[model samples]
Target: MSTPVGGDETQAPQSRFAGITAALRYPDIRTLFISTFANQFGQGTSHVIIGWLVLDMTGSALLVGAAFAVRSAPNLIVGLAAGPITDRYDRRILMKIAVIGLMLTALTLSGLVYFDVITISILLCGVFFLGAFQAMYMTARQAYVYDIVGANRAISGLALIGLAQRISQLIGALLAGTTILHIGGSGPFLAMAIGYLIGLTCIFMLVEVGDSAPDRQETIVENLINYFKALRSNRLLLSLMISTAGAEILGFSHAVILPILALQVLDVGPEGLGLLTASRFVGATVGIAGLAIAGDVKRPGALLLTTMFFFGISQIVLGYAQTFWVAVTLVAIVNIMATMSDVLHQSLLQLSVSNEQRGRAMGSWIIGIGTAPIGQSEVGLLAGATDSKTALLINGASLAILALIMAALLPKLRKL
Candidate 1:
């Protein structure tokens, strides 16, 4: 069979382009790329604003974590149903509605903030709705990339998409911090609303026909059963999902406590928090771009494991960082490894699964990611009990230890 980028056997040699720019050859993929950047930009902005806003309101680490938890908790609720819906419907249509929902949610939040009437309850409700839309939008987006590019180039396609997301995040984080400093919390929400609207415009421009028939026409319960059966049968996919959850729970969840680090530990204020967040994305963008330019990987599973090992070490050191610059350096290293691991995880899953089951497979992946709330909340609880640095040190050391064990045990997964 022909590859996603390579047209046919006759053109195989010519289609071996090393650059990620090759994915842009498809018009619809281009639109997807732009829309992804916009969505991530809004998220990047929210990442900064939400933590600071919560901290400002309750002055408690637990509440800050709870605020972010509420945002992602919806993924647990809607993640299972998202895949089946994506598989049964046109992903393009799903994306259109999802983006609209995100825009309205952001706008409503902005209005509440501007009027100075927003409460924790109201913010959590808005975040929950936003998370629900995001869950569906991202699942469809991942599957839609497969529709544009096939499995052979899935890694490269996802890497480039990650690159775009990181770049937008870099910009969004920096802008959000500056905006919040000058205009308060309302500014970031207004900016997020605008970003979602721009994302909707890009989605509207996508011309792909995204409808597809499922492999089986069973009832929803039957389909859910079959999905679990498939996961059980495919040990690689199951292992990958487990590893993803471990990484998220251990390493990536430190994002929620960064505001505390900025305020109490580093004493750099909101601007410093923004810089720290932007630094992470800058490193992520570099790692993803390097992977994209390298093209096809010979040992992606091994690469994922190796990167994760370093990620844990970075997290460990970040816990002990006493200076702002020191924390920034550690965050950069942590994100580079984190981004590589994520791309590898998604690529391997997409390559292993069939198109009909792609949405459900990714839904399972989302559910694993949803475990971030547990990790984040733990960090908050620990930080409140002790110190932010101590919380991070413990989290990081645990992650590294777990990653080592997973690598040693999952030889089958390592080979892929």
Candidate 2:
């Protein structure tokens, strides 16, 4: 793979080139990458389709926010348990089971929609199940990456997955919107279900590649206790987890306000909303590509802080934009910043932790990422009372404040 300019010999691979090369180099990574790309493409499309469905159903921003909240609520409730469960099973098996569960759930959802029995309540209920399965699946998947590539190559592997997901999102969003416009919401739901099935098939064909040792014999309670004990001893990990949680809280919370911003502030429609969302993927793709080329830049902490600062500023810009095009541009910038921050945070967390506890650690890491809907609920309430733009401005300012505090407290992060 050719390296990017200014990158070390090992680090110089162009993000796009490197991702493909890395995937090709490792069979296990390639399988996981391909499966996840398919899953995310469907998922990205489903997100837009579902959100549009809810909005069309109720025309209430709160309901849309509630839909997102329902999706995330399971993570807050069940996320902590996922880590202990993942540690006790073969991650590959766990992922397969999770994917199956998701497929079934999607099938159930499609049945309702196909019968014309779907309602907001039904959708929300289905979303809850999907979210629960997703939490477990994500925990297992993150851990599995480490098993496939080892820690040294983990960041590269993650970048590749991110790249795949971004590209999928870009394609999926446009595809979903167009599909829904012509075929109704059922089309997207069925497509997503099929995608999950494909992902499951891919996993079945995969040959597990690292750490095939039988799991240590331990009671569930024993594993839970050990995980807590480990967490207690790792202050850096704890701090990193907290910082990660805070960032996600700030970021995902915007989902509640964004619909309102589109409908009221920017006066845009579903197409505009799709465009705005796609712009984020575009920015993310660029950011991921940049990072792949940069390859392990020093001072990840500083990069994190700077990226977050940009994220906050971009949100504020998004809130203030008067036209649809401007909103799309601001969202793109925010996505770029967010993509870099996400990569930096993941790399930092992976590098900071020990191998034995990686699954548990990453499970904890996602607890923060997954709990954003709770914060979004609060933002939704505020938006309900005030204007969407004001709510966004407030959230943006809060993120800026948190980023500044994090930067000051974690000097090491500043260097990165």
Candidate 3:
């Protein structure tokens, strides 16, 4: 039987996967892993494909940034609702709907491309809707992992799922590049749609995990009120949310300028851009694999801050990389720290809350990262005004400083 978060873990099934941890033994977790792989593949594919499309169309870094910013705009809208919605419904079905949304958007894009009627405005609108579904899927899947694995193995469950996500990102990015070259015409969007379709089927295969805990979540309005109240009371949660936002705003925003780097800096084409993108995911996969091998962590919060600091440091170095392979290596290093920061923040936040609040907490996490639009636009603008290298240098320094400041100011966060 699937164990709900906050359930008595000892009473759940004792079955274990022979080569893996207790978390993978649960069939639901395994199914979740498979679905997450497909889901993230579509996600990773869409981002690169769109960025390339924008660059190809306008040859403007600023416009590319705007398109990506539009893609992230849905996070702010859907993030708040995702919490209560996830808490209120069957997570599997919610995820299923989200995957279908992804498919529909991909199909729409393919059709638009095929007709040669794809404009910046039309593309931005489709990207916005596509991001909406991706945000929901991201939020629900984390809560789903916590529910099935419980607190004891939350790290393992999430890390394993992260592995799937990272691996798929690597493949998706590489394939997106190849497809853009080989298939040419509506191939990228069609590939994204197919990935989402496969992912949706995997979601249906998940054993239904219902949250029937005695203290069911209250109404949406009540949950919002409670969220604010909890934010006030839980300093660590507040710190986490802010820090998560800071990471996205400063560190992750560098992704917005990647097209510039590929064309102007790295002197590469779309296929080469794919290699650059995959380099980061390769780093993420390796970092997560290390974490998974380490098993349960004793100080995820402290480690998270450390990763954030290094994340900044790596970006600073990345700004100076002139050679293509050198650039790839630095990008990978940056994401190794980036993915570690992500996994730690997520696991720490999930462990901090009771099962009743888990979904909302994940939603809050989504909202935190939803701050990406501000960064995407900022970095893009900065690249437009200055060079890509200068923008990365400035943003990287700010992120490192932010990490150190948080470490000093938030004692409770470090202790966690």
Number of the top candidate by lDDT?
A: 3
Write the residue-wise lDDT of candidate 2 on 246-301 in tens digits. Answer: 77777657756656766666767666666766777888888887776555566677
Candidate number that wins on TM-score, 1 or 2: 1
lDDT ranking, high to low:
3, 1, 2
Error of 3 at 63 (Å): 1.3
TM-score rank, highest first? 3, 1, 2
The C-alpha stretches of model 2 lying farther than 4 A from their native spots are: 1-20, 211-219
Please give, for residues 1-416, the per-residue lDDT of candidate 3 as tens digits. Answer: 57533334455433333113666667788888888888788766776788899999899999888888888888877878998788777777788888899899899999998889999889989999998998998888888887777677777778889999999989998998888888763788898888888888888898757333215867778877887788899888778888989999999888887788897778799988888888879999988876765667788878888899999999999999889999989888999899888888888877676677777788778888889899999999999999898889999999999999998998878877
User: Model 2 — which ten-residue stretch has the worst lDDT?
Assistant: 1-10
lDDT of 2: 0.73
- lDDT to native, each model: 0.81, 0.73, 0.82
Model 3: what TM-score? Answer: 0.94
Best by TM-score: 3
> Backbone clash tally for model 3?
0
Model 3 lDDT, residue 84, Cα: 75
lDDT of 1 by residue, 244-360 (tens): 788888888888778999987888999999999888898899889888877679888888888888888888888888799988988888899888988887777777777778777
**Candidate 1 versus the native: TM-score?**
0.94
